[model samples]
Target: MKPLSSTLAPGNGGAAGQTGLETNNAGRDMKIIATGLLVLMAIVYFTSKSYEEVHPALGFVRAFAEAAMVGGLADWFAVTALFRHPMGIPIPHTAIIPRNKDRIGNTLANFLKSNFLITRIVAQRMHGVDLAGGVGRFLKSPSGGEGRLKMGASRLIGDIIASLDQDRLGSMFKGAVKSQARDLDLATPLGQILEVVMKENRHGPLIDSTIKWAYRTLDANEYVIRAIVFDRANTVMRWTGLDDRLANEVVDGLYKLLADMASDPEHPVRTKSEEALAQLAVELKTDPALRERIEQWKLEMIENPAIADWIDGIWENGRNALLKASRDPDAAMAGHFGDALMQLGSSLQKDPILNRQLNRFARRAVAGVVASYGDNIVKLVSETIHGWDAQTITDRVENAVGRDLQYIRVNGTLVGGLVGVSLHTLGYWI
Candidate 1:
């Protein structure tokens, strides 16, 4: 009895005992049919030997036919056993696909990563071509780029305006204030600002008006002054028994004295206030306790609901300002920003050196980011490659060209047989 594999060999000229599957594949089908026909032919020749003694030439034909059947069946079995169990008997080491589908997928992934997605291939693709340039081109191009830029600007402004929630605004303000408190020495900035205010004479007019109001307040309250003076005169009259008219005269004089003191800008009280403020500044600067207290007081204020309310108001104001700017592009806020932007653009346009520096910085900044993340790209490929299924790799390749490869086997059989016969005839003639 022949082993089942020999007859199933798809292209080889083997024996007649090949399995039925060779007929299923297009290339192997004809070989299988021919194998069967050859077996029949051999059987016929031998059977004819009974009728008439057959020549040895017929025996050679019988040998060739038998061999072809064996080759066809063996090849057929070998191919079929790869994808399924032989005859569906579920034999061990057969039907590898269904048993290990995940492994197949993994192997396929690995093969792709190794062969198609290697680092050199990736690096070669990455070299010399300005990815940054492409993005810049896309953004800065004249063809609809200006429109896109405007749209992007509008969207950005809109999103910023919309995303300005109270919590976010509060957080931002809190951050700004906290940084100023911690990082900025308020005394210096405040002093400088106050100096500027003083230098500009902005505070002088206000202070002068306040002093003039104090003088007016005294004039308005002259009766209170007169009452004090009259009351003192009454006491003096009781002491000296002076004339009533003379006492009244003394009281009137005292009234005038009180009014003068109140009216004077160089009054002792006003001078003392200025001195006290100066002393307070010294304490704020030199006194650690005072500084600590200031910080504590600031922290308390920041935590206060008033601060939160102020943040809300600020956010609302900012939002309203932005909304106004967005709605009316020619509004004051928008106009100011536009003017500032135009100035900046004009400066960049004028300053060649500065423009080149900016361009270089922008390019380097992008390159830096890519260099930082490049390793991750490499790792992704390697890790993927290291985890795929071998069989899956094989199967995918086969599917891509499996039908084509079947022709190779068919052509090989025909071509090999033709060469064999030609050589055999050449030798016979020689």
Candidate 2:
């Protein structure tokens, strides 16, 4: 992962480019100064040599200028040879950086891998870093203006979702659901749920609902019941209206039974229903045959086209809803997501244990990445450098340290001039 600073700032690359440009300009200016000093020394040397016969002091001046010129030229040659051949001459051991660019790249890569990319070294360096706290602070109150972080994060999420293949995503989601369902032990969970219901007497409401439904059905179909009674009745009984009287009695009796079941919680029918449910729950859990049947049913359901279609529909609806929510600026989901992030950040900040765990996890994750991909990273660096042209490598190296090297030329010229004057004095004294 890129550093947070680089990730957050889009202009970092431009800034780095500008910095390199500035460094190159400084190096170029220093090179001109160093070369101009050598030219000045040469002019002085010739002028002082002509006046040496007129004044004895001119000999010392001539010696200083000549020595300064030689020292400056030597230093310039050394500096020039590093990046390219001196005066474009193909001198041995010249153009050192360009000729050995590949070796330098490999050496640099190895140095980085050995010193920085090792898991142990990385872990040690990251030991004091409060990654979790830093993240928490960033999320809670970002560096940029208010709501900028949240908005950017939301936009990123929206883009990612928009770019995905919805059909493929839906298919993958459906497949995952099917796989989970296929592996799930439906019988055991069902039994556990049923047991909880029974323990809490939650099945009472179900019984009451059943009774009410039965009562409504019987009331609405009274005529149907009466007609059935008439079809079974004798012709004499129907003609005398006795069958109608009997149907009314039967309907009234059924209504009274249902009423009793509804009014009485401990009614025999209710008790019997509860007992049956409890027994089924136990059979679901403990009975091997029943469990096997449930497993087979679960497999069938997983294989059913209707179930697959239902899963696909679920994925489609969910994906569309998420997409719409992500796109909408004033969406409740977006607000909720932001709020959740803030809450998590607050929790991480206040909760030491959670913060520590998160930090440990982050460290381990980073260390694992370094251990796994360190070699690949080194190889990439080496290959990238090796692939660059010789001139490109030379310019980069020169820009980085060329100004300092120019200073070396200036120092050598001054130092050599002082030494020459000292030597002339010593020889005259002898």
Candidate 3:
């Protein structure tokens, strides 16, 4: 914002033009009337002096006119001296405003600093204001403030996205993701998750699913299993004992064994499998060698060219989608932002603790700003005043108060004349 002094400067054009014109006209009219009165007095003084001996009343009139002229001229000189030298001649104590511009500026600045910029005054005013509450109420108003906020947000986001360098953003996104992945160790966290799953008995579903999958595989590949068993029997004993019936019986026994394992949770095979899985979970958590191997595998996956390309693709695709959404008016990205802001405002209003904290934060921020920069405002006022042209300052000030000053000239003439008449009457009586 421009300084207050700048706003009052002469060249800063504004609505003051018509008002200034009226003041100027009034000052000019007053000056003319005062000058006319002095001219009338001068005429009476000269005419009455010639007839004073012939008319006693004319002698008193002459005295009044002389005093009136003197008073009017003196007042005119005094008023003119404030803005400029009387009759354009150099005179001491004249052109007061122009000559003392710097001092006047300093005085004005000091006045403002002492009266308006006091920290206690500012803090007291701030304390009386509920800035956070006011904002919350405005957001929650039914006067379409929320709709305007949404539209404003949409335009702001659109402008920002339009100005962005998409390629640069994508590159930065990929680099950050890769850097974070490289610095992270996944094995220990994964092992801890597995430990939690086993401890919580969440692994039962997984074991049951595994058994069902194995049974389906065995049923589907029965012919292959039987063929393999028959081939094994031939290789071991070709001439004497093994035959088709025995192979069939062996395949039937294998199927029955899998059925038993799937149906009975207490079977030896099931018990052994659970024990082995439990041990593996324990080893993953406590064994350093196992962890090291897992870490090596993780590193290989992260560093692989295919994985890097996939990560880059994810960034590029996401960026493109966001950019497209930002440009589309119907995308609702800005609407979502507005809704989130409204929700936040509602929360702040409903939550007393949050509202209090927000107000406190605002107070501290305002106090910090005032404490740090309040002096600058005073300096700015002084500088702006100093920068104004002397004549411009005179014209503006005279225009503002010149009408009132002219009345002083009028009163001086009338009072001086009245005193002269009273003195003449007293002298005659004596």
Q: CA lDDT of each candidate?
A: 0.54, 0.85, 0.78
Candidate 2 lDDT, 1-430, residue by residue in tens = 2344453442344445678778878988988898888899899999999989999899898889888988888888888899899989999999999999999999999999989999998999788999989778755654336455566565556667766777788778988998888889999999999989999989888888999999999989999999999999998998999999999999999999999999988889888999999999999999999999999999998888998888888988887777676555445334667678778888889999999999999999999999999999999999989999999888777778989999999998888788878888888999
Tell me, by TM-score, which candidate is best.
2
lDDT of 1: 0.54
Model 3 lDDT, residue 228, Cα = 78
Candidate 2 overall Cα lDDT vs. reference? 0.85
Better of 1 and 3 by lDDT: 3
C-alpha RMSD of each candidate structure in angstroms:
16.7, 6.4, 11.5
Candidate 2: clashing pairs of residues? none
TM-score of each: 0.38, 0.66, 0.47
Give a tens-digit lDDT track for model 1, residues 143-237: 34355554445544655565557567767866786567566566545545655564564654555666567667766876675566556665666
Give the CA lDDT, 0 to 100, for residue 278 in model 2: 97
